[model samples]
Target: MNKSLAASVSPALYSSKTNTKIFTLTSAEHNIEVGNWKIDSTQLGILDTYFIIEQKILHGGKQEGSKIITLTSPNGLTITLSPTRGMSIINVIGQDMRFGWDSPVKEIVNPAFINLESRSGAGWLEGFNEMMVRCGFEWAGHPGLENGEMRTLHGKIGNTPASEVEIEINETAPYEIKIRGLIKESTFKKAELQTLAELSYTPGTHHFTIHDSLTNHADYPRDYQIMYHSNFSKPLLEKDAQFVAPIKEISPFNDYAQKGLSDWSAYLGPTKDFDEMVFNIVPFSKTDGSTIAALHNKDGSKGAAIEFNVKELPYLTLWKNTDTEKQGYVTGIEPGTNYAYAASIEREQGRIRQVKPGKTVHFKIKYSALMNKEAVNKVKKEITDIQGNQKTTIIQKPIAKE
Candidate 1:
């Protein structure tokens, strides 16, 4: 990563009658608004087309010695990734609108905070406010033996580091930006698992796509688990927001969620000491083989949606923790290859997926910000079409505000 910025020259157009400096930097990662360019006293052809990619090194904290990648497109989309943190997406900004949550800890911390020593993924939970990836080998739950190894919270994939990274920018006909990386987890003489992950965005679209290939190089078949822990907060997850999904059934994971079932699709303002709730969802299969989840803001004017292949990632986990303004006021719409349960439990239930030796599995997921009423309505109609005439059960309203 370059520690200092390099100067760039501006394009110049000199006419016998008029002179103007048209500043333009091509194929550069960072740009400075030096000044506006004018041609023939007319503001006719000024366009910003190139996407920017820059690296920043943090200092004086747990994030010290860490490298973070920031991808910015001309369409007002900004994504930040921490390579040291399993290439986890820490933040996302679309159309000058914040889509993901922000944690109390503003800087990236050490991966040790979520190491094996800290059981139950409590360490990972402490800093769990991002578009994070979870549970690769030994999922965190049940705390039982997994092939003679203990299980802990979700898994350690989010804490794992990437071994290789490649960034590609296409400025030609089809303008797009791509980030590809590899994360590996293995034992000295045991299992070896790797995931090739790619995130891509094209110009003129307010969306991005994630494609992952999980491979096992072990001599024997290896069980693996993964979940896309994508979260939404604040402006996007406002008080009157609604959760829409084409799910066959919704099971409350705990009493709190069971009690709030009536308003399960609705959101509330951040309240003090609000109990965190989890809901397990079984998505309905479609001929197109895709599933979606959307959150429409208070007035239903705008929203955001995520789509994934139900065949590859079968489970969905909806997490709500509107505890407080500063502590946690966000919700997560997670899609996983397996239910986030004890490895032994999922294996016993035959929910665990296996990658045969020398074989690979692939998953494709997309996320888009719905910028208008029509976009929000389009997603709602899709969900309804999938559900058909199945009567969705409606329960009691949420606990009334004091």
Candidate 2:
């Protein structure tokens, strides 16, 4: 057999026409060549997976100075990470199912992706939505800084950019790929904090997982806040879509949501100048300490689900916006340690968390999608079985937006 053609054949099987006995080498440690034939371990069918990673710089726009790294899987999963923007997953595509929202801004590569520049003292709302945006290490709300500096919409971490980015691919059995990045948030004479985020995925499965560790390297104890802000839009979040979560109780952020309390899980069509609603979901986790939240179309054609550890992220926030096209209609599934209130409010509410110097905290979350009825049922049953038919109360409060 020709050397090139024999390389593709199963080494365990003999080609009678070749008049030679075959021996399969399962290990990739050997480089045996005989009579111009080379035995390649990768072609032994040990694993079926492939991945590609690319780093590129943007140009011709405000984001021109920005940079991004993209990781794609052979099984139809593509993720774009902004190392210059808190290492956030700006875009996600998988199995004909898209989970991220379409923001009013068209790009995530620049500071212009952020909406408002000046602060009006209202809850910070100038954020640019991405597939997954990290919220904080110091404060994640709209109140002014401790030194009286007006706070930006979201925290500064999302705009801080990563320092050391690493990518690894292993073609071993149960093939996997991982991307790790380090981001730091510091002040002039204050404490410094760092977050190391690792995102991993396996081909042939519509799932991805995140593992993060935040460390407070300051000499004294410091307060910290963090959240995983994941958004969904369009086809999966269409009119009549349903939301399922293991909620123990829910609190509406304003009167608009109060009036729509009965249909908190119901989605409506976009309207002109529509008011956005925010709901705080107190979820119940399974015995393993994990909770689940999901959304699916009315006809169950497409959907997405998320699982997180309640111990790490006890608070879940649901953001619903059905405004006009220009304003952008979207929904967000947020899990964090604190609510999306002013830093002062969170402090007063005793929801802010503190980390001992030299101590590290870990957070993990998993994401999967449903492309058909079978996948939908599996997610529904999992959530139902995790939390029984427990009814909870909804508190109503009002918030303002300019």
Candidate 3:
């Protein structure tokens, strides 16, 4: 694959692969004093049996970009960082995941893919997340030609620049980490900001905010094709899970969306009843937590929940696995300004964020578990007032525009 293809998919935000290695990512005397938080890159490097981020550190794929970052836990959970740089996980110790996949066999050789016995606790992804504050994807494809069966990706990391990464820890508290990054091309050089933020869960009470500062560094003019790729396991999709946003429609990921990242001309059916999955940038009816996006399993034993204000994330990309030949465990619940191959659309509409040589751009995202109807009603009332009985266009829920 080309460099742009690799970099574009660097962080495998919604990947389903297996790796087993644990690298020691020790903590430093960090003193950013961002807030009451602990930044322990070492502990952060540890993963549960539940999930892992696809960093593309091992088993090469096509050269997607300059670097790639991935995370995985013993519990069969994974978050990939190709397009983005970081991820934030919550309440991990409670799930039983597939460990046989990420663990190594004692062949007693230097396995390129991953080695759990040599590294820390199979948390190389997290350690790498803090090792340096910058990197990109390089190559991506199947694990190997003859013997390798795993489809993997690879990239260069923090080795890109020199900047201080902060990690602080407090007993029974939410941990916070921060890193600074940059991207420079021929006529542009802009700073890329990222953070792994977490707030103590309060069941259905508290909300968490994620922030980033994206700058366009081109000397002349530039356009930023920004996308937020969020990943969660299949078990999270509960019967109550719904999608709500300011979307116009959803395009399916048929042969078109796959071959070209921006292709969305075809509308594939909901992947095996996974209606929350879409390929096009669909319209959402989210006023303040509208159910425009969803993933529910009616069975109700295992499920996922989501509640976000559409004002921040206007576009979304819902991905699910339907190929009988493929097997994976997670789906993508992405909220962003651009979808695959849809960057030019935002640029043409002047929605693209541009940055000059020393400029900065800031954006924020907040997520939390929703309460009962009363809480949703309260939010709805506030948003309703904000929208106010307007005789405006009424776009279909999660449907695309003409």
Which candidate number has the best lDDT?
2
Candidate 3 whole-model C-alpha lDDT, 0 to 1: 0.32
RMSD for all candidates, in order, please. Answer: 9.3, 10.6, 13.8
TM-score top scorer:
2
Tens digits of lDDT, candidate 3, 29-141: 22211211222224445322122222222222322222333333232232222222233221222243111111111111112333322222222232222211211211111
Expressed as tens digits, the lDDT of each residue in 1-402 for candidate 1 is 111111222233212112222222121233222222222111323245545566666676777655577777656577888766777888878764677786676667757544654654346665465665555653543345667665656677777766555554443434566666667788877679887777887755788898888888889988777778888886778777899998787767656678877677888888898897777777875787787888888887888899998888898888888778798788888888765556776777777878899998998889888888899999989988888876654333321110
Scored against the true structure, residue 185 in model 1 reaches a CA lDDT of 81
Question: Looking at model 3, which ten-residue stretch has the lowest summed lDDT?
Answer: 97-106
Candidate 2 C-alpha lDDT tens digits along 296-315: 98888778899998889988
Question: How high is the CA lDDT of each candidate model?
Answer: 0.69, 0.72, 0.32
- Candidate 1: the clashing residue pairs are 140-152, 140-153, 140-154, 262-395, 262-396
